[model samples]
Target: MRILQLHVDFVEYLPVKKEIDDAEPLLKNEKELIEDTVVILTSIENGDDETLIEDFVKETLDYLKKIKCNSVLIYPYAHLSSSLEAPKSAFKLMTQLEDALRASTDTIVVRRAPFGWTKELGIKVKGHPLSENSRAIVKKNTERQPGTLVEVVSSKSDAIDNEGSVSSALAAEKDLKSNWYVLTVEGALIPYDGYKFKKSEINLENLFKYEILRKRTVEDQPPHVKLMRKLGLADYEPASDSGNMRFYPKGRLIKSLLEQFVTKKVSQYGGLEVETPIMYDSHHPSMESYFNRFPARQYNIKSDQKDLFLRFAACFGQFLMTKDFQISYKNLPLKLYELTRYSFRREKSGELVGLRRLRAFSMPDCHAFCQDINQAKIEFLKRLDLSVSVMEEIGITPEKDLEMAIRFTKEFYTNNKEFVQNLVSKIGKPVLVEMWDDRFFYFVLKWEFNFLDNSGKASALATDQIDIENGERYGITFIDESGNKKNPIILHNSPSGAIERVIFALLEKSAKMMKEGKTPYLPLWLMNTQVRIIPVRDEFIPKCAELLDQLKTNSIRADIDDREDTLSKKIREAETEWIHYTVIIGEKEVATNSISVRDRLKKSSYSTSIDELVKLIKEPMKGKPDLPINLPEYLSKRPRIAS
Candidate 1:
C-alpha cells in the first residue's frame, strides 16, 4: 500500500460524480475540518487484504501522534498508485479502514472520502518541519535482496545494539564468530566474559543503546526537561507540531552562543563558510539516487506540482555547491562550513524528548575535501582533536562529561590499524570500537563523543565521519599534479552535535550535580546574568548602580536587583537563576569601598573590591564569546518567567 501523510491546518473537499459503478455512498456532499488534522492520501494496492487495512490504520495513527493530530481523514487517493485494487475491493477497504481507525484509537473523529468519486481538495499545510511525509509500507515477510557490505569488530569485544539489531542487518555475521573482548582503560584487550567492572562502572554494562529513537523505558520527564522548563529556557510549542520546540529568550541566547563558538572554531581552522537552501527537488536525477543511499526518512512536499524533500543535513547544499567549483590540488583540503538553521527528520513520536533528539534542531556542519586517503585521514584526526576541544570548552571533559566510540569498516582497519590505535592512545580511555565486515553507507570510519545521563541514556555530542562516496556521486573533483581530474575524499564533522543536544547535556549534567546534593549552575560564560548586585536598603541603591556600571564597562555581565524584596530573598533568587556572582551592598561595604561577593558556583562568599571581582571573573572567561543577557539590566523592569 502507498500512503502520504499531511499535518494540515485545514482541508476542504467536495464530492463530484462517481467514476466507478461500485462507488461507496457519500455521507456528505461537502466536508471540511477547520483546525489541525491529518489527511492520509491512501491507495489500496492490487494484493491488499483485511490484514493490510489493519496494519495501515496502526501505522497511520502512529504518524498522527508524532504531529499531534488526533482527528484523521482517510482520503481514497487512487492516483498515488497505478496498480490499484478493483473498484469493489477499494470501496470495501476504505470502509474497513475508517471503522478500524475509530476502533484502534481513543480519538473521536475519523472520516473517509467517498470511494470512486472525483473530489476537489483544498489543503493548507502547517509551516512547521515534519508537517508532511511520504511513506511506502510493504506487507510482512517480503522478499529480501542481496548486497555486499563490510563489517568489522574491534579484536576485543563487541557492543550490543538493541535498537538496530546490527547483527541481523549484516548478513555476513550470520556464519562467522570470533573471540570478543572489551578494551580496557590502558588499551589492553580482554575477553568480554572475563572482564570485571568497578562499582562506578557497573551501569555501563546495562545501558540501553539506540541510534536515534528513544526506548520505551526512558523516563517521561528527565531531570533536564524539568529544569529547562523551570528556567524559562525552552518549551514545547502546542501550536506547532511535536519535536519542534519554541525557545524562550534565554534558551535562544544559549543556542546562539554555542553556534557562534563552534562556527568560529571551524573558521579558525581554515574553513570557507557558506549558507545553503533547506529544500531540494526529490526527482532531481542524482538526488533521487542519492536519497536511496541514505538510511534516513525525509519530509516530502508537492510544491508547484513538483516533488521535493527537505535536506536532512548540509550535504545536499554543500555537494551541489562544490559540483561546479573550479579547484586544484593546492587547495585539496578545501573545507566548507554552514550553521544549519534547522534539519528535519521524521522521528517516531515515542522518541521525541525535550531536546536530546528533535525533529527540527540547529546544527553546525563542516565538510572538507581531501586529495587522497592519506590527506583524508590527516584531516579526520584534526577534527577528532577539535571535537575533544569543543567538549572541553563546553565544560564536558573526556573523563567527566563524555565517552568515546569509534566505528570502522574491516578493510580500512586492516590497512591502517596503527592510526586507530593512536586515536585511542591520545584520548587515554577505553574506547568502544565497532568493526563492520562490510560497508554500510558512505563512511569508512566515524567517531562520537557521548554523554551518558543518570537515566542510562547515551547522547552523542560531537562526531566526525569519513565519507568515501559522495565526492564522485556529486561530480565534485579536483585536478591533481598529473593534470588528471580525481574525485576527492570528503570528511563530515560537527565539532559539536546538535546545538539543542549540547544544551540538553549541560542541563543534564547540572541536574546530576543537584542529585548529588551539590548546587547546579550553568557554565560561567553561558549564565544569563553573570553578576547581580543587590542593595541591602533603598539608600544603597546608588552604590549598586556604580558597581554595575563599572562591571559592564569591563565587559562583565552584571545587573542590579532593584526589586522591592528582602535582601535574603534577593540573594536566594539570584542563586535560583544560577547567577555566577551575587553581591550584597550596604553601609559598611560602601564605606569600606568593598563588597561581599556570593559565588553561586563555589557556594561560598568573600569580601572583594569591584576591580578584584572583575579580574577574577575575566580569568575564567578569557577567549570565550559573550552573549547579551536576555533579561533586563534592572530586576525591577523584568516580569517573572518560568513558573
Candidate 2:
C-alpha cells in the first residue's frame, strides 16, 4: 500500500522547492520523514565536465537541507530521451546518491532501475524498447547452452550468500545477437543486461518502511487475503493484485445457474440479452460526468493515452450500443440484461470486507430503455418481480429473510420528484428508504434494494436508477412515427449488487442461522450439490449407488458418500458445503426400496420414495411467483422527490 512520490528536476530549483512544501503537509505526522537529503552528480551524455555536474548536485543538496527536507530522489531526466549511447553522468549520480543516503540514515531506502550483466538476469521489461532484442538473445543462448539457462537455484545460497558462482554459471551460456543473460538467483530467475554484473533487488520492504507498509503486520494484510482463503486460491497471491478470485469450479456452477435463470426469465418477459467490455475509455460521458462528481470512485489509465477505466456500471455501455440504432414508438420499452463484472471505490481500507467491497466483482446488471414514464414503470415492476423471483429461487425469502425497496428522498429526487413518486407508486413498496438531505446529488429518481443480515443490519443489495441526467449527458434519443425526436428514459438497475457480496452475505446468514439451531435451507435450484446420498452402513452401499445414478440421470445435483468416515461425519461435511438435502439409505430402506431424507435446515429425517422427494422439492416452483408486498400502506404511499 506504500506509495513513493519521486521528485526529479534539473531545470528549475524554485518549483522543486515548492513541490516539497506541498508534499510535506500530506506526509506530516503521518509517516516517518528521512533526516538528510542526498544529491548525486554524473557526467553528461556529451561528456560534459563532471566537475560542473558535481557542483550542481552539492548545491541542490544544500538547498534541500536548508528547507528542512531530507530524503532525495535523484533521476537524470535529461538523458532519458537522448540519442547518446550511454549517459555516464546518470550512472555516476545514482551511485553517489546511494552512498550518500546510506551514510546519512540507517533506514535509507534507495530506488534504482534493474540492471545486470545480461538482459536475462534482470527483471522482465514490460513495453521496454530493448525487450524484443533481449528476448531473441535469451532464446538463442538457452537453445545453445541448455545448462546455462538454469530454472531453479537454492534460495538460501543465491539471495542470502550472494554467491558469484551462480552468476558465473549463468554467464557461460551461449551468446545470441544481443549480449544479455538470464540468471537464476535466490531461486528467482531474472533477466539482465550484459553490461552490468549484478542487479539490485526491489527492496520493497525498506522502500515502504517510511510509508503505508510501515509499523504493522496483521493489520496491514490486504482485504483480499480472507477472500483468497475463502476461495482456496493458490495460483496468485491477493497481496499485490487487484481482482476478484475467479473460483473456476464454484464460479462455473453459480454462473451456469444464473445464466439459465436469466435467459428463461428475460425471454419470457420479452427482454434481450446484451454483452459489453469490462473496461472502457473513460471519456464516455457517463464516466466523465461521474468522475466530475465523485472523483474518488473513478480510476484512470495514463498508459492508454485515453482516459480508460474499469466500468462501474453496465448501463452506460448498453446505452451506447443502442444509441445510434433507429427505434420507433413500437419499441416502447426495450429491456436489456447482462451479467457482468464491475469495480467500485471503497473509501477506507477497513470498509473492504470479504467480497463486500472488492476492487473487482460481478453483478447481474440490467437497463431498460423506455419511450414514456408509464413504460418505464412497467419495466421497473417487471424488474422488481424478477429480482424477488431470483432471490426466492436462491433461498432468500422477502417477508422473513429479505426487505428491499425503491429509494426516494430529496437528494435523489431534487430534480425530478414527480418521476420518483410515479416509480414508488408502481413498485407498491417502500420497506427500505434512505431519506436524503440537501447534500444528495445525481439522478432524479433511484430505487435501492436491501436485505437484512443475521445481525439485523440492513445492507443494500441492489439499485435501480431513473437516470435523467445520464440520458441527457449521452443524448440517447428515440424517434416517434411522426418523426419527433425524444430523449429515451434510461433505467439503471442491478438485481444483485455483486455476486461475491451476495454469496458472502448468504454464507454469514447461514452460519448465524446454524448457530441459532436453524438449518441452512436452500431453495431447490441454487444448491451446489442439491442432494447427497449417504449409506447408513457399509451394507447399503449398493442401494446408495443405485439411487445416486438415478438422481444424476434426472439431472438433479446429487452425490454419494462412500468414504470410510462415519455417517455423522459425512452428513456434517455435506451440511458444511451447504448441500440442500442428505438422503440416508440403510438396510431397512434398501430392502423396502425407500430412503430416509434429512432436510438441511430442519435437522429431521423422514422416509420417502425417490420420486416423492423430487416432487416435494419441485412443488414451490410450480409457476412464476408474484413480488411480495410486505410494506405498510402509509410507507408505500410516501411521495418520491427529485434529485
Candidate 3:
C-alpha cells in the first residue's frame, strides 16, 4: 500500500465522469466543489489485506498527531502505484481507511472522495520537510518494524504467510516459493550432495522444470479429479456444497484403506485412539481463542440459540480429553489420536479442487502431550517417521513424492538449534523454514510434508505442529516429580494429512506416468479391481468364475468381465480401469492349467498359473489391510461412473 501525504494549505477537488465500471455513483453539479483540507493520495495494491488497513490508519493518525492536524481528506489515486489492486478491493480499502480515520479520537473530521473517478484538483503546496512525504508500506517487511500495529485477529495466519499461499516453495528452485532450513542427517545441517536420498523411480523431479504455478479458479478442474471420476473413485456431488465431494464405492474403499492404515500407524507410535464431538460451542472462550490461532476457516452452526462451530481438526477434542485425564510425568508423552471422517474446513471456492482441497475430509489428527520440549522433540520425530512410513506404504515414495517444510520461532532456533538440525539430518534433505520473531501459536516449531499436484500447487499431506500454548489454554496439565501442576508441550500431528488428498496424490502420480507414455493405475491393494478374469467364450464362463473365486480366496480383489461384449472390447475396458493384471482363459489355458496374464505395470503379456499370480499380488500387499471391492463382481452388473 502506497500513500502520498500532501500537507497542503488548501486543496479543492471535483469528481468527474466515471473511468471504471465500479466507480462510485457520484455526480458533479454545475458548481465546483472545493475544500480547505490536507489531502492523502492512497494507492491500494494487490497484497493489501484487512490488517493492512488498521496499520495504515494507525500510521496516518501518528502523522496527523505529529503535524498538529486533525482534519484530513482521502483521495484514491491509482497513479501513486503501478501495481493497483482490483477495483472492488481498492474501493473496499478506501472505505475501510475512511472508517478507521473517523473512529480515531485524534481526528476531528475525516472524509474520502468518490473512488474510481477522474478528478480535477487544485492545491496550494506547503513547503516544509514534513509537508510533502511519501511512504511505501510492504506487508512482507512490516513484521520487522517495531511500531507497526497489526490486527492479530484478522491476520493470525496471514502474519506468517509469504503470500496467500501457506506452503513453502523449494529453496533451490527460484520459481518456487519455499521455507529455509538447516538439514542434517549425519548429525548436522548438510548440503544436498552430502548424503544420498532413497529416491524412487517416481520420476517426479522433472515436474519442477515446468514451473507449473497455480491457476486459482473454481472452473478449472484438477487432472486427478477427472481420472478419479473415470476410475469410479469419487466425484463432486451437486447436492453437497462446493469442496464437498461424494465418494463412490471404489473411492470410499480407497479412503477406508488409507484411514485404517494411518490409524494403525498412529497407534503403533503410542497414540491412544480417542473420539471427540463434531461440533463445539463457539462462545466457549478457549474454543474461540484457538479458532483464531489456527489457520483453517470454520463452519458455524446455530442450534437452540447457541452458536457452534464444526470441528476443523481434533485439537480441541484431544485437548479437552487430556484436560480430564489424571496424567503424571510418567504418562507425559501421551498420544491421543483420532481419524475424523467428516472434519470440516471452509476452504475458498476457488481453492477447492477434487480431493487436493476439500471442505469436508477425513483428517487423521494425533496430539502427543510431552513433559517438556525435549520429550516433545522425541515424540515429534516418531510422528514424522510414522508419516513417512504411511506414505511409503501407500506407494508414495518419500522425497520423490513430497517435500518437507519446517516453521519455527527465533527462540526455538536459538535454543534448540541442534535438535532442529538433527531433524533435517534424519530426513536427509533441506527443508523450507518460516521464522517468526515472536511465538504465535502453541508450538515453537511445526512441519508439513507437502505433495505438489499435477497443477503444480502443493498441498500439505502430513503435518505436525509443536504447540506450547494449547496445554495452558485448555488447562491440560500433568503432575511433575514434585507433584506440582505443569503445562505439557503439545504436539499436533496429522500423520496422514487428509485421506482424500492421499488418494488425490496417488491419482496425480499416476497422471504423471500417463503423461510420460506409461500406464496410469492406483496401487493394486487400493484398486477397485486388482485383477480381471476374462473367458474366451461362453463355455469358459464357469472357468473364469472358478479362477475369480480362487483369487478372492487368496485375498486378491478379483472380478470377471462377464459382459457379453467382444473379447477385444473387454480387454480394452480392463486396460482402461487400470486393472493390474488381466487373465484370459480358453481351451488351451484350461487344458494346460495355465492362464495368459496381461501385466499393466510391465506392459507385457505372459502365461502364468493362478498360483503364481496370487503370490505376485499378495507379496506387495502383505501386512496391508485390504478393502473389499465395492463394485459388482461382474462388469454387466456395474453402472458406468463416467460416460
lDDT scores of the candidates, listed in order: 0.77, 0.49, 0.75
> Which runs of model 1 end up more than 4 angstroms from their true locations?
1-181, 184-194, 199-218
Given candidate 3, what's the lDDT at residue 562? 82
Cα-based TM-score, every candidate = 0.73, 0.57, 0.72
Worst 10-residue lDDT window, candidate 2: 156-165
Q: Candidate 1, residues 540-631: lDDT per residue as tens digits?
A: 99988888888888888888988898998998888778888999999889889999999877779999888889998888887788766777
lDDT of 2 by residue, 274-350 (tens): 78887777666556555444333434456547657667767667877777667777887777777775544422444
Clashes per candidate (backbone, < 3 Å): 14, 34, 16
Ranking of all candidate structures by their TM-score, best first: 1, 3, 2
Model with the higher lDDT, candidate 2 or 3: 3
How many clashing residue pairs are found in candidate 1?
Answer: 14
Best by lDDT: 1
